[model samples]
Target: MAQAATITIGSKVRVLRVRDRIPADLVEALKADPTGTVTGFRTVDGQGIGLEVDLGAGKGAWFFDDEVTLA
Candidate 1:
């Protein structure tokens, strides 16, 4: 798991896994390339934290903290 203290905006990270259902296109995109840059953070379940990652070529997705690690 990535510690919130260690991750910040613009950090590089890699998708470890998806914990929730997402669009097929995004899933395929992640399969093709799981590494991306952290764009920002979002609230999940009104408590947990989610990371917004830019997968390049206009691709981006939000992932749970545990689903990603510093790359």
Candidate 2:
């Protein structure tokens, strides 16, 4: 995991398009239903950070919380 950074709502985050895992779909789900609980995040070269979001109630998912803006 790279150095953690601060992220806030309304930020433009990237989508980790993992095959059959969690792609843009998951990202949309998060936007639709943001539980406010950050599941996972990691930084990558050029690609920015990847985020795994657990939407709670077994409705978990993953995406790239890349362009997240800190409040």
Candidate 3:
């Protein structure tokens, strides 16, 4: 399988859009301002591809490669 585009740690990323795969509760908050910093990688289905972004002010969210972009 081809690898998805992933943001590097400490890089800034913007939430382009949230997918149905994301939990409903997190969708709105994640898209509120549409910006965050890549803090780390998260595991999903045994793959360390999920991107962890910190939105600052103690707020943060994790999104897959397709949900965010370099900002």
Candidate with top lDDT is 1
Compared with the true structure, the alpha-carbon lDDT of candidate 1 equals 0.91
Over 5-71, each residue of candidate 3 has an lDDT whose tens digit, in order, gives 4457988888887665766545666657778889888877785477889887677778778777889
Q: Once superposed on the true structure, which residue ranges of model 3 sit more than 4 Å away at CA?
A: 1-6, 21-32
What clash count goes with each model?
0, 1, 0
Candidate 3, run of 10 with poorest lDDT: 1-10
Write model 1 residue lDDT over 1-71, tens digit each, in one string: 34866999999999999988989989899989999999999998998889999999889989999999999
Per-model TM-score, in order, reads: 0.90, 0.41, 0.71
Candidate 3 residue-wise lDDT at 2: 30
Tens-place lDDT digits, model 2, residues 1-71 = 23235543333333333434446765576567555455566555676665555555566554455322222
lDDT of 2 at 14: 36
Q: Please give the distance, in angstroms, between residue 2's alpha carbon in candidate 3 and its true position after superposition.
A: 7.0
TM-score order, best first, reads: 1, 3, 2
TM-score of 2: 0.41
**Number of clashing pairs, model 2?**
1
